[model samples]
Target: MSLLQKIQDLEDVLKKEQLTVDDLVAAISSEIACNSYLVSAEGKILSYSLAGSNSDKNADLALKLEFKQRVGFVFQTVANLPLEANFLENDNSFAPNTHMAIVPIHHLTSTAGHLLLTKKAQQFSEEELILAEASSLIAGIYLYEKANENNSDSQHNNIEMVLESLSFSEIKAIHSVFTELNGLEGFLVASKIADRIGISRSVIVNAMRKLESAGIVNSRSLGIKGTYIKIKNSSFLEALKLKVR
Candidate 1:
C-alpha cells in the first residue's frame, strides 16, 4: 500500500468501535518496524506488541516485568511535560544503550496517556521522533473518541446493531480477512489467515462461507487448493469491527 493509504487504514482502525490499545500498538509497530506500547497515566500497561523469536520473547517478558515494577516512576517523570516528545538512552526499565522514546497522548487539552517505543538500535533520527509524536497524537484521539462513545447511549445502540448478528470468532475471521486483503487483488488464502488468527482452518472456512452468504465476501473453491476468498463489501466488513464501546 502507498504511505497515504496505510495512514488511512490506521485512521480507520482507530475509528472502529472495536479499537483496543493493542490495536494501536500493532498499527504503529507495523508501520515503524519496532515494538510499541501504550501505557495509561495510572501506570497500567494498556497494550504492547513485540513480534519475533525466542530471544524477543525473553526480552519482552523482562521488559513487561520491569515496566510493571517502575511504571509509576516513568509516569512521574513525564507527567508535567507539554505536548512535546522525548527520548531516553536508558530508563529504569531498559538496559544501557537500549533506545526508547516517550510521547504524550493528549485528550483534548489534557494528557491521557503515554506511548513508549523501543528498538534494539541505540538511537532514532529527528524525523522518526517527529513521526512518533504524530502517531501518539493519533492514538490520543482514538482513546478520546473511544471513551466518549462508550458513555453515549446512541453509540452503544449503534454498536449493538452492528455486532448483534456476528459471533466473536466470526468477527475475528472477518477482521483477519479484511486486514489481509487490503489493497490486494486475486484472493486471500483461508488457511494462511487461519494460521495468523490462531484458529483452525475448518473454523475459518465455515466463517468465510457464512460471510460469503451474507455478501461480506466472495468465496470460490480452488479444488484441492482449498477456497480462494475476497472481500466483497468493504463497508460491511468495516462495520464488523464494531465493539461494545
Candidate 2:
C-alpha cells in the first residue's frame, strides 16, 4: 500500500485486531534505528526507511543468504550446531556500509531460516557494521520464531527422519554395545564383532561379500582385544548422538 493507504490500513488493522501501531512500527523501527534497512528472510524488501540504503547492491548479502540456506539444510541432515559454529564471520572486508553478515533463525540447533541487511554504501563505519550484524542476528531469531510457529509439519518430518537414520536397526545394534566393547587387543579374530552384533560367524564373513551395503557393520583388526573393532559408521554414529540429544 502507499504510505497514506498503509497508514489507514494500519489504523484499521489495529482497531480490528485490537492492537497498537507502535507495536508494529516498533519492530521495523528497531532495524531502522540500527542499520536504516531491513530485509525479509528471502532477501526481499521489507523496508528501506533510511535514505542512503544501498539495497540495490545487496548482491553480497544475497550470496551470503544462499550460502546460509545451503548450510541451513543441515538442520534436516545434522544435529544442532553450537552457536559459534554457524555464527562465525564470513569476510571482514572492513567496508562499513557494505559490511554485512547472515544471521539464521535457528532453534533446537537447526537453522530454520535467516535474514540479511538490506543495503549499505561503499563503506560502513564500525558502529554501522556492528548495528548491521546485530540487526541481522535479530532478524534471524525472529525468522526462526515465525518458522517454528508455522512449519510444525516440516519439523516433525525432520525429527522422524533423524530418528530413523540414527536408529537403523543394524547400526543401533552396535551403538547398543559400543560402550561395552570387547575386541582383540593383540589379534583376536573378526568373530568377536559378529558375536557382539548377534550375527553368526559365517554371516560376518559372508557379509563382506557385498560392498557398501547399508545397515551392515564393518570391522578391522588392530591388536590384542582391540584387534577386531566394529565400525558401524562414523558419520551415522555422530548423527545418532546428535539426534538422541
Candidate 3:
C-alpha cells in the first residue's frame, strides 16, 4: 500500500481502538524510526516508547527537561519550533537524540494537551513531521471523543479530563439546557437544546456551536431535508476496539 494509505489505515485503527494519547505516541515513534518517544501531559510523562531494547532508559539519557518545564515551555517549544530545528529547540534532545517535534492539541477553544515525537537529530526528516502531525490529528479526535463521552455521564463535566491537568467550571448552567433532552428524539435541533436549557434562541445556537466546535456532536443541514445534530462518540466503554493490542 502507498504511504498515505498506510497512514490512513493507522488512522482507522486509531479511531477504532479509541487510541489513547499513549497509543499514538508509540505509533509515532515506531513509524518515524525513532529511538524513543516520550510524551508529557501537563509536564508529567503520559507515555513513553523506547526505540531499541534498553534495560534502563532513565539512567542512559543525561539531558532531560524539568517536570514543570516539560509540561509548558518544553511542549510550547515543540509547537512553535520551526522546521529543521534541532537541540536548541527542545532540551529533550541530546546527542543520539537528533529529531523532535512538539504538537499542541486543542478542542473547541481551549487547549486539550500536547504531543512530542523525538528521533536522533541526525535521523529526522520532513516526513517525520508529517507522520507526527498525522498522529496528533488522530490523537485529537480520540481525545475529543473522550471529552464528549465524559459530558454524557457527568452533570458538571465540561472538559475532556486530558492529562488530569486542566481546570474548568462545572458548566452546570450550560449543561442544564441539555438536562431535559432525551436523545434528541430522532436528532435534536437547536430549538430543543435551547428550550430545554431555558435560554434564548441565540444562546442555544451558541451552545450548539461550541459543542460542535469541540466535536461533541456533528451538525448538518439537510438543506430541504432537515437540520439536526448527531452525537459524536459514545463512552469509553462503548467505544470500538480496533485490534487485540
TM-score of each: 0.45, 0.29, 0.47
Error of 3 at 209 (Å): 30
Q: Number of the top candidate by TM-score?
A: 3
Tens-digit lDDT track of model 1 for 103-126: 767666566878777766446555
Q: Tens-digit lDDT track for model 2 on 1-245?
A: 33444334333433334333223333433433423334443544333332333334333332345544554443322211222222223434223334333334444544444433323443334444444434444445455554565665554554345445432443444444343444311234545666776766554344332212443345564655543444443444455466545
Order the numbered candidates by lDDT, best leading. 1, 3, 2
- What's the TM for model 2? 0.29
State the RMSD for candidate 3.
Answer: 13.1
For lDDT, the strongest prediction is: 1
The true-versus-predicted C-alpha distance at residue 117 of model 3, in Å, is 1.2
lDDT of model 2 at position 175: 42
Q: Answer with 1 or 2, whichever has the higher TM-score.
A: 1
**lDDT winner between candidates 1 and 2:** 1
Consecutive 10-residue window with the lowest summed lDDT within model 1: 76-85
lDDT of 3 by residue, 218-245 (tens): 7776655435656554331122111111
- Preferred candidate (TM-score higher): 2 or 3: 3
- The models' CA-based lDDT, in order, is 0.61, 0.40, 0.50
